[model samples]
Structure formats: C-alpha cells, structure tokens
Target: MEVAQGLCGRGALVTGAGKGIGRAVAVALNRAGARVTALSQTKADLDSLEQECPGIQTLCVDLGDWEATEATLNTVGAVYLLVNNAAVALLQPFLEVTKEAFDRSFDVNLRAALHVSQIVARQMIARGVPGAIVNVSSQASQRALQDHTVYCATKCALDMLTKTMALELGPHQIRVNSVNPTVVMTDMGRLNWTEPQKVAAMTSRIPLGKFAEVDDVVNSILFLLSNQSAMTTGAMLPVDGGFLAC
Candidate 1:
C-alpha cells in the first residue's frame, strides 16, 4: 500500500493569492509539495508570485462577480485543500453604509467563500478524497469594530457557515474550519493602522503587544490544512495575539 504523503502530491487552491495572507499560504503549500492553483484579480501580483515560487498555476478572476466566479470554477480541476482567503473590506460607518458597499463586501467575503467551498468540496467528494478547508476570517467577526459594520457582518456569517459546513461535510471525511486573525501587518493593514495612537491602542489590547506578521497567520493556516489537525473540525482557531482574551 502506498503511504499517504499528506499535502505532498495533493492539489491545493487559494483565493486572493496574489498577496498578503493568501500569497503566503500559496507559497507555503507549494513548498510543502502541493500543486498550487492561485487565484486573484491582480496580474502583476500573480506574476510576481509565480516568479518567486516556480510551478504554481495562476488564475485571474474576480470572485465578486457571481457569474464570473461560477465560470471560473468550471475551469478548476481537482483540489484536496481549499483556502477561502479572498475578502474585501469597505469600511463605512453603520449609519452611512451604502447598499452597494454592503453588497460588495458580502459578495466577496461571504458569498465567494461559500461558492468556492461548494465547488471544491464537490470535487473532493467526486474523487473520494479526504480534504481540508480553511476560511480566512477576521477578529472583527467576533468583536465589533467601528466603521467595519458590513465587514463584521459578513465575517460573522462566515463563522456560522463554517460550523454548518463542518457538520454536514464531516460525514464525507472533509474537515472545515476557520482562522480569525487580529491585525496582520500586511500592506493594507499598515495603511489602516499606521497612526501611532491607533497602533498603540490596538497593541495595548493584545497580550502579545504586537500585530501579526503575514507569516504568523500563514503558519496557522498551514497547521489547519495539514494532517496535524486531522481530528480538528468545526473549529475557529484564533491567530490573534490574545486580543480576544483581553
């Protein structure tokens, strides 16, 4: 009998893979021997990633468009690991939030994740392969943040969806979970939290007294996708620096 090589020889898919946490996850998976299919809208980012990690397949698609996303999924082949990391944050105060902003936020963050999971999970079932899925959630999902009204709602819904997916997909040997991270110092993160007062306030709340590096979140994602988390399902692992604990 052939021994299972875990991620090796398996196919992996990551969305929003052009940069930030998604980029990190895609690179890590490829290094671990998985054939990676990276999806993102930015061509330059994808091209740069390909140069950095040879042999990674790239797909440029906007997951926010429902019809386009469905069409894109048809082109995807079998994948054993799926990371729903693509998300958009349109920060607006609750009172001033527009319909378009709300729809776009939910469409990409919540709707896209569900659609991709459905497509990937179906492929796993058809192949009779045990698989793992990790949704890149946010700490805002649990704790409310000012001006993040819509973003918070979508993530909160995603968290609940993860639990339901785990419940139903568990019978098929597919584990589903999410990682809720605090402020990760990616390009976008730094832009929002660059002010000294904002940074200090945020850090003071976290027990670690520092924001997450992209790799910090990436390592957590890798753990959830690997066999090391074989017995874990319906779990929401926090990659926060103890912010929620405070």
Candidate 2:
C-alpha cells in the first residue's frame, strides 16, 4: 500500500493570511508540502507568515481594491487550491449602518471573493487543473446577530456565490464550498468577546460548550481542499462548535 501524496507540488493561495484563521490555513498547507502563497494587506503579517513557514510566498494587496486585485491575480501563476478567507465586519444597528460601511463590507467580504474566484478558476480551467476552493464564511450568514446586519448580509451572499460557482465549475472539476464558523478564539476574537456576559451568552448557545479554535477551522478547510472530500462540493460545513445545530 502506498500513502496518498497530499498537496505536494500543488500551488495554493490563501487570502487574509495576515492573521487568525487565514494564517492558520496557510501554515497548515505549507506544512503539507503545498507551494503556498499567502495574500494580505499588511506586509508585516506577510513577513511573519514567511518567518513561520519559510518557503511559502507572500503577496501584499488589498482585496477591496477591485482593479488592483484583478491585476495582482493575473500575475499569479497556476493555483490548484484557493482559500478566500479575507473579510471585514462592521457591526452596527440596522438603522445606524451607513451606506459607506455597508458597501465597504460587501467590497471585501462578497465582491472581492467573487472576483478572486473568477480569476483563479479561470486559471485552473485554462491549465486543466482540478482544484478546490474554500470560502471562509461566518455562522452569521445563517443566523443574524444584533449589530451585524451588513456583515450577515455579505456572508449570506457569499454562501450563495459558493453554490453558484460550484454549479458552474463542477463540469470543469473545480469544487467550491464554504466553512461557517462561530466565534473563533483568535487574538482579536478574545479581545472582542472579553465581556463575561457576552461570552456566557454566546457559549451557552453552543452545544460543544465552547468557541472554536483557529486549528479547528483550519482542519475543516484542509479537509475540503483535499481529495478526501472529492465528491463534496457546494457544501457549507459548519465549524461552529455545534452552534448551528443547537
């Protein structure tokens, strides 16, 4: 019996690789022997990622910048796996949300992901490379939270985009899916959820009795990208500590 060659020699791309879930995914993929390229708006974060995983490449660009993102993607070589993990959340009451904030949220969370998919999927098709794409969405996409009106909307739209992309790209052997996670215990997440009342309220709702860790979500992303899930596409798997089920 031979061991399966996993991600070795494959070209992988991960957005929002500057921090949190994105950073974890990039590191895991690199360790699995993929030629990983991490994209982030912050050069410092990219530098840190490179230090953490020596041979991985890094790209500095704001996904919200439409033209620049497209141009940057065009320059990237063939990519076999893509993880659209970049997103921005502006939590405000429905009526208090300004048009600018709403648009900006969509710019990064939804529009940018769509554009990235188009460019990368095109490259895969032209190269005849069977690939996988995982979009990092939030549990907010399915259940609304107070002060998360705009953020919720964008994630919901991203899930739909995942389905549509999967439908269209399936014929070409390109699988598209998404992972919806609850509050992940990243550095920023800890600061934001520090209020005891907030923590208790959120945790009580999860059947698992806790929030997610970065590696938890990263493991799901890697599973979706690997051949282990070869027949799974257009699926939205939850890494939410059973929040959705509860």
Candidate 3:
C-alpha cells in the first residue's frame, strides 16, 4: 500500500495569512509539501510566516483593494486550493455601528472573497483543473450574539456567497465550502476575551468547555482541501465546539 501524496506539486493561496488561523493554515499546508503563498496586509506578519516556513512565498496586499487582488490572481497558476480567511470583525451595537466600520467589514469579509474567487475560479475552469475553496466563516453566521451586528451581517453574507459559489462552480469541478468556528484563542481572541469574567461567560456557552484552538480550525481546512473530500462541496462544516448545536 502506498501513502497518499501531500498537497505537493500543488499551488495554494491563503488570504489573511499574517497570523491566527490563516497563518496556521498556511504553515500546515506548507508542511504538507504544498507550494503555499500567503497574503496579508501586514508585511511584518507575512515576513514572519515566510521566515518560519522556509520556501513559502508571501504576498502583502490588502484584499479589500479590488484592482490589486485582480492583478495578484493573474500571477498564480491553476489554483489547487484557495482559503478565504481574510476578515474584519467590528463589534458594535446595531445603532452604534458607523458606516465606515460596516463597509470595511463587508469589504474584507465578503467582497474580497467574491473578487478572488471570480479570478481564481475562472483560471481553474479554463485549465480544466479541480480545486477547493474554503471560506473561513464564523459561528456568528448562524447565531446572533450581543454587539456583533456588523460582524454577523458580514459572515452571513459570506455564508450565502459560499453556497452560491459552490453551486455555480460545481460545473467547473471547483468545490466551494466554509469552515465556521467558535471563538478561537488567537491574538484577537485574547484581546477580546481578556476579562476573566468575560472569558468565563463565553466559555460556559461552548459545550466543549473551552475556546477553539488555531490548529482545530486548520485541520478542518486541510481536510476540505484534500482529495478525501472530493465529493464534498457546498458544505458549511462547523469546527465550533458544539456552539451552534446548543
């Protein structure tokens, strides 16, 4: 019996690869032998990942910029995998949310994914290659939480986008899916969950009794990107610790 090959010889692009889950996913893919390209708006973060994972490529670009994203897509070959992990979370009351906050949230969380998918999927179709797209959504898409009006709205839109893209791209042998996780213990989560009481409060909601780890989400993304899930598409798998189930 032969071992299955890693994502070797494949080209993968992951957005928001500066840190957190995106960075974890990029490293995981790189270790699995994929020629990974990580994109981030912060050069330092990109550099750090590139340094940590030798031979991995880094691209510093704001996905919110439509023209730049379009141009970047042109340089990549038939994308074997694309992880739309770039997102901005603006937590504010519905009435207190500013227009700028709302627009920026939508731009990064929804519009950017749309722009990149259009460009990458076109190349995939033209090359007659099969690929997978994993959108890093959140549990907020299915449930409401306090002070998450704008953030929830954006993720909800992303969920819809994932579904529609899966439907449309399926004919072209492109699989589109989403991985929704609960509060991940990343830098952002640490900042937001710093208060002991707040941490306790949120932890109580998760049946798993703890916040999600970065590797938890990364594993799910890799699974979706692999051939094991070849027949899977249009699926929104929750990596959340039973957060939505409760």
Residues 1-246 of candidate 1: C-alpha lDDT, one tens digit per residue:
012238887899999999899998998889888899999999999999999998899999999888888898888778999999999989999999999999899999999999999999998998898999999999999999989999999999999999999999999999999999999989988898879998998899899999999988988888888888899999999989998887
lDDT of 2: 0.92
Candidate 2: regions farther than 4 A off: 1-5
**Per-residue lDDT of candidate 3, residues 1-246 (tens digit):** 012143677899999999899998898888888888899999999888877998788888898899988887677655789999999887899889999998899999999999988888888888888889999999999999899998998898899999999999999889999999999989888787889898888879889889998888988888888887888899999988898889
**Evaluation by lDDT, superior candidate among 1 and 2:** 2
Arrange candidates by lDDT, descending: 2, 1, 3
Among all candidates shown, the one with the greatest TM-score: 2
Q: Candidate 1: minimum summed lDDT over ten consecutive residues — where?
A: 1-10
The parts of candidate 1 lying over 4 Å away from their true place are 1-5
Estimate, for each residue in 1-246, the C-alpha lDDT of model 2 and write its tens digit. 011145777999999999999998888888888899999999999998888888989999999999999988887778999999999988899989999999999999999999999999999999887999999999999998999999999999999999999999999999999999999999999899999999999999999899999988988899899888899999999999889996
lDDT of each: 0.91, 0.92, 0.88
Lowest summed-lDDT stretch of 10 residues in model 3?
1-10
Q: What's the TM-score of each model vs. the native?
A: 0.96, 0.97, 0.95
Deviating ranges (above 4 Å) for candidate 3:
1-6
Residue 215's lDDT within candidate 2 is: 83
